[model samples]
Target: MSHVGKSKILFVDDEEVICSMAAEFLEMQGFIVDTYEDSREAFDAFCRDPDDFDIVITDQVMPKMTGIELLKNIIGIRSAIPRILCTGFSEELNHKDEKEVGIDAFFMKPYRFDDLIGQIKKLV
Candidate 1:
């Protein structure tokens, strides 16, 4: 599935491979994707221009800050922006109430790009 407009996305993952692959896939689907391996840098970029992104997809595990921390910062800046938390660890989801934390969607790692696209479509 492909999106029509170029909806800008902030995608954060500690893994370089994941960031590169996701960026390529999302760009192919007609979305403008900005990827970051460092959560702090991603948060800084978001702060620089909060309105620049329509969606934020981040991995739970990261170096400086966890995805939850990054999402919380983003939410404080732009509460309405759609946020998706992706993680390989089930324990991460178990520890927090996603709705309460302002997450729009939760995706497991090793997910299909089509599924991710579907979520983006629904949220956007």
Candidate 2:
């Protein structure tokens, strides 16, 4: 499937392999995807210039900062931007975290590529 508008997406993960794979998949699905290995840079991009992306998908377990922290800071700057927190945790645990951040979605790591695409589609 292809997108109708320019739905820019940012994928943040400390792991290059995971980000690379996901980035490629998202691009193939017709979204403008950018991958970042550093959470700090991703945070800066989202906070400083949220107009650059339509949605953000970030991994939870990172080196310097957690995804929740990054999302928190970004939400402070741009409260309207949509966000997705991707983690290895179950949906039950994610639900507890959801109350605070108000994310557009919570995606588990190793998630199905098609399912991820579906989530993005719903948001965009």
Candidate 3:
């Protein structure tokens, strides 16, 4: 179902399995997904070609850097790209914090793929 003009996504998570799985799922839905298991590395990739991606979906509580920190850095360079924070640790971030962090959307862990798709479509 891949399309030439599908929205490109950068999905970051310290957990390799989670990132890979989500990437596969999103890809099947026709999105171009690039998965990163390290937030720091993801930042570097984003910096190298910020315009290559349309949106970013990342997990919180990473090793070298947190997702919020990554989003902040990305915004500093390119503020218009949509960002989504997806984490199992809901207590670590709330609606107010998400807004303060400049994320366009927030999704809790175990979110439905369809719901995520809807948000992605809405954002991009």
**Highest TM-score, which number?**
1
- Cα deviation at 118, candidate 1, in Å, is 0.9
TM per candidate: 0.92, 0.86, 0.90
Give the number of the best model, judged by lDDT: 1
Q: In candidate 3, which residue ranges exceed 4 Å CA deviation?
A: 1-5, 94-97
Q: Which rank order by TM-score, best down to worst?
A: 1, 3, 2
Model 1 pairs in collision:
none
Off by over 4 Å in 1: 1-4, 94-97
The per-residue C-alpha lDDT of model 2 at residue 86 equals 88
Q: Tens-digit lDDT track for model 1 on 68-113?
A: 8888888888888989999999786645556656878888878999
Query: Clashes in model 3: which pairs?
Result: none
Instruction: Flag the better candidate by TM-score, 1 or 3.
Output: 1
**Candidate 2 wrong stretches, greater than 4 Å:** 1-5, 90-97
Alpha-carbon local distance difference test for all models? 0.88, 0.80, 0.86
Local lDDT at 39 for model 2: 94
* Backbone clash tally (model 2): 0
Candidate 2: Cα lDDT at 45: 71
